[model samples]
Target: MKKVLKVIGITVLSFIALIIILLSFLLIKNYLDSKKPIIEDTYYKNFQSDATLEKKYAGLGSYEVSLVKLKSEDDTIKEYKIWYPTELKSKSQAYPLIVVTNASNTAASVYESFFERLASWGFIVVGNEDKQAGTGLTTSKTLDYVLELNSDSDSIFYGKVSQDNIGVIGYSQGGAGAIRAVTEYDNSNKYKTIFTGSAAYSLLAKNMGWEYDISKVAIPYFMSAGTGSSDDSGEDSKTSFGGVAPLSSLIVNYDGIRNDVFKVRARINGAEHGDMLTRADGYMTAWMLYQLQNDEEARLVFIGKSAEILSNSNWQDIEKNN
Candidate 1:
């Protein structure tokens, strides 16, 4: 009877242990899921493809700027803007291209005005509108677009574009997309250069379990982020996002040469996320023209003059713990 009691007790304990282990596993999974940010509903209203609209409007001014639309393999309609100097003409219009990505929820059209400024500096600028949040219109989509543009280089839509001389630039969420693009799509040495503003702490975030790897990009990248908020409205957002902590950490770990890997420049002060594209004192464009085109004057303006202005600007600093 005592032997029988012992066997029953062992069985009960074994079952209890198994139940405890399963419950612990379930609790951990729930905790991890709770920690992640919930993706918000992202959608745009009255969306118009720049390609169709620009065709109807024709080209204008000394530099031509138009909207281009592309359809991905999955039938995803992506929007982008094209800009190039008029003096280059059609046949002589083989200008370098820059792909700009905007904030996570913002569209490429939001940064359209900056395209003109970049175009005036003698390069073709294309701003990609993010679809379904700010992950990217989709990496495969940007690659297909570049490939299509390359294949159809003789077509009127892309005839003037120099597919061989490709570059990319992005801000905020677009910056993340830019990194993803260069890492995954621009792998074939198609895009020789890349630039980003207020790049997300993707790698660091990924390392923390998010799984992003934009820092692996082995091209020339000029990256920057605001130091502080210019207005009071951005205070809460800035505090929550960790500001420049991720970018600074990435740069500190950046094992790249000045001419290769990535060249990162950060602007501190009360600079907000949207301010990265502002031409208030030519802070953003100056650096872009220099690195993207190897323009000496633009480089000086970008590194020398812009730094001075940023020094005087009010920006926030990322906290160390972040």
Candidate 2:
């Protein structure tokens, strides 16, 4: 009887050991997956022509900006900011409009660099003031306010905001809001593209019952994040980007020069969540120019020669759904 008992104990101990080994292996694999692959400097050089590169990456456009205190009826967007070219009125055609939401516990002005940079690219960027982490009501409200301004002949954006092109962007909580904007509000013309920076993951979404399936979104979506803890350690960004169908090229019908989808991961090795507030100069703009303006140089950065450069880096985990 004692021999039988000893045999049973050994079997149980062995089973536990095997379980621990399996768990340790999985943890190691996940850690490796989150790491940068390798470094290649030649592939990292500026790949665009002098003129095109300057136009998209330089942020040198002479654009003026304005800020407004919104009324109480504005849902969640209590305040807003606008950045437009000083020459907006001089142009015959309307310019694109892009709306932005801020990270939780911060205000719209915190992302002033983000809005102003996109504006320098010739889009009318509207930054929303929101503090809530779980709700995106503010994101949709920004566009609604733009529509109102565009319709009001007395308003500054009247006849100046292009209805055909619109963009939504956000960071952290606002990143989640940007996703909610299109998935919940569902407007094709107003939300032509969505770029999320270090988006809040499902845990936060679950707390508010605000989570939505990424598969439901049909537009071009780009997810950018830092592997650092500041960017949620790419926690949600990984899951979000991975959830989408790699057939995004067919879904959004991006330009014919590329065969891959518009959706992919831009995992910067050293970047953090708040770093997006001031940096992300070329990384974010390239996606916008590629999607909104169909800029060839920007497209090249995504899937062109510049992309070839990025593929050689071990500091970034650039992946697409497959």
Model 1, runs deviating above 4 Å: 1-76, 86-89, 132-140, 157-159, 186-188, 203-210, 229-241, 244-262, 279-283, 302-322
Question: How do the predictions measure up, each by TM-score?
Answer: 0.61, 0.68
TM-score of 1: 0.61
Compute the lDDT for candidate 1: 0.51
* lDDT for 320 (candidate 1): 17
- Evaluate residue 155 in candidate 2 and report its C-alpha lDDT on the 0 to 100 scale: 74
Candidate 1 lDDT by residue in tens digits, 112-143:
55566557666766655553324544543564
Model 2: per-residue lDDT, tens digit, 1-322? 9999999999999999999999999999976653432222222233332334423463544466544444546655666777777677666668887777767666654445555556767778877556673466777767887888888978767788877778887777777777778777745336788887766654455455557455555677777666555554323332453221122211231222133435666555565656543344455677777788777777766674456326534225565442
